[model samples]
Target: MPNSTTPSSSQALEAVLARVDAGLDASLERLYALLRIRSISTDPAYAPECQRAADWLVGELSGLGFAAQARPTPGHPVVVAHGPDQAGPHVLFYAHYDVQPVDPLELWHSDPFEPQLRTDANGRQIIVARGASDDKGQMLTFIEACRAFKAATGGLPLKISLMLEGEEESGGVNLPPFMQANRDELAQADIALVCDTDMWDRQTPSITTMLRGLVADEIEITAAARDLHSGMFGNAARNPNQVLAEIIASLRAPDGSVTLPGFYDDVAELSPELKAQWQGLGFDEKQFLADAGLSLPAGEQGRSVLEMLWSRPTCEINGMIGGYTGEGFKTVIPAKASAKISFRLVSGMDPDKIRAAFRKHVEALVPSDCSVRFIPHGGSPAITVPADGDYLRKALSGLSAEWGKPAVITGSGGSIPVAGDFKRILGLDTLLIGFAHVDDQIHSPNEKYDLDSFHRGIRSWVHVLASLAE
Candidate 1:
């Protein structure tokens, strides 16, 4: 076990943190250089920019004493940089250089690519740009940490294998294949470090230990052979819309918990310690509900807001469509209704099992006159990091020392496909220490990153490397 009495280490990092603060202007300059690259992976036009972004990372990593290169992949290139792959516990640090597009350009107070250092309403300074927070701002936290370590100890203490992908925001299709082919090169590490998540509120630093997995399902409920006029067959004809509603209603109980059969069979309950930690959040129900313009809890009854959003499993309807009413009301009973639903599963809850349960629920809800067809979109199970792992504890201590605040262990409601890819392709666990804030608005307009988070995040990594090296 690593000692928590690293006052000297803390003092050393404090000095580096001050340096990071004084040199924050230069860091912003670097970020501006990256943000200027329009590396949107989803669109074909930004392909060259994507490669350019990878090249930029190669330069930065190489400057830090790593033999880094921009490796060509099937689509965009991956920047693989290494310092030492030898003895001490290895870590695969993951991030993405590619960003989302800036459409509806008229909405911006300033150009999206040209980063501006602005302050939010609460007087917190933020870096405003398209990719400022989504990743560029976030990933630099780790890179800056490495820089601080280099400045302090002359090198990064642990064996570091950095893998920054260009296609993470898009579906990560190329990443799994690459990991499959280079398992030895990538998965040699005991654990992976991912910086794609967010901080809990603004004051609380969190480590994402659990992420609910998902299974995308598209279901079409077919009733009559043709669209029926409500006046012609108001009482006799079966309505697919009604059938679809019945199917959705049957998915969960009145208490707001998912009712799919066997959905809870494999789910593991949150432990006492985790429960206490979540409770300590001192969550305000009104503020949380108000943030969404809501007044009621939508998940399982009697569970804390943290539990419902992070720990509990759920089945939600992403979309629904059937009939047409373009202008005024059209009094026609739709012939078919379709709904897309997904389940947020916990560890051990197989997507296959949840899929089967969902289908069975729909089948039971289907009327004798109608047939239902299902379209499988995608499926995956939940991820739970080993709470007792050695490196896990080190990371926790690292955050505590850097921020002078106890690190909060929490679960994510959203999912990252690469974490699952690491397990499926290379049998490795991921340590997610993300620095993005909830209000960063990553994929949307007006994206920003807190200046404090950007600067402190780097120092956090410095302490983390020291802990891991020990």
Candidate 2:
């Protein structure tokens, strides 16, 4: 086991952090080198660039004494690295090396592949590039921290595994299969760590503990045999548009709750401790709505916006297609209307059960003559790391110590399926810790990673790993 004494451990942590501070410039140079690789996994033309990125990671990890290799997949390569086997907690670190396609090239001030350090209007020194804040810069923070640990000491404090994928920006269709095939190797870790997330603010660090799952479904309703002219059959025929509208409206109540039968049967309520933590976040509901050009809280009245976003299950209409939608109006009632709907599920909610309830509700609302068909897109369950886990407390304490503020436990309103994959396939819970800011503009033109975030991010990991080693 690693040393847990206060004085020696503190001194070791301080030394590692000092090493990170001294090596900042060299770390930036290394990050810039990786950023220059155009690893756009979605585009077939950049396949070689993706391979180059995987190889580069393999080389870096291997130099760190990890048994690293670029494993091939149907689309891109996955870089798997294993650190020295030691008698301590094992962690699987996950990050992506691929970047999103940078369209609207005119918007970028410089080459997307050419990373530049410049001061922003806010007076923060930022690194600008396509994948600066998304994953490249964020991922490097951990690697640099490990470098510091090895440099300051001699080896890592614990067992570690690295899984770097080149197809995260694209659909990670191959990752689940890869994990399943290598389950025995990957599942040896006690926990997982992911860095593709953002901080609460510039000064406040946050760890996302809860991630809502998703269920996407498309439904088409047919009322009449063919399109009918309103002038020719005004009130004589039924319009599928109207039928679809009523059915859609019937799914939600005036109080902004789902109308499906027993929809909340399996829903779990927040713990008192978690609820109190969320209340302490000082979230402004009006400001949040104002930013979105909305003036009202639209879901489950009497709940805070943060609660609705982070903890509650939600049903929303994503899109709808009915009747004619063109420049010139067409006076015709279309024979078919389709709507795309999605549900955000919390812990204890089953996606299959929710889907079945929605289909049953829609079927009950349809007219006897009308027909409805449901098409399923995808589904995944919510992920929650036990609040009382040892690693969570250690990581939170480490983050708090690094940022000079109490690290806030937060939740994501969207899904990160890889976390769920680790749970289902590897039986490991993931800690979603990152150092990017809310305005990093990831996947957009002129994306950036704050210099402070990068520097302090490495330091944070140093402390976290040291704490976890205890």
What would you estimate as the lDDT of candidate 1?
A: 0.83
Best candidate according to TM-score: 2
Range of the 10 consecutive residues with the lowest summed lDDT in candidate 1: 1-10
**Residue range 1-470, candidate 2, lDDT tens digits:** 45432214567778888999999999999999999999999999999999999999999999989999999999899999999887778999999999999998999999999999999998989999999998999999999999998888878888889999889888798999999999999999999999999888888888899999999999999988999999998788888888889988998999999999988898888899999998988888899899989998888999989989999999999999998998999999899999999999998888899999999999998889999999999888999999998999999998999989999899989999899999999999999999998789988999999999999999999888887887
Per-prediction TM-score, please? 0.94, 0.97
lDDT scores for all predictions? 0.83, 0.91
Backbone clashes in candidate 2 total 0
lDDT of 1 by residue, 46-85 (tens): 8989999999999999998888998888899989988754
- Model 2 C-alpha lDDT versus the unseen true structure: 0.91
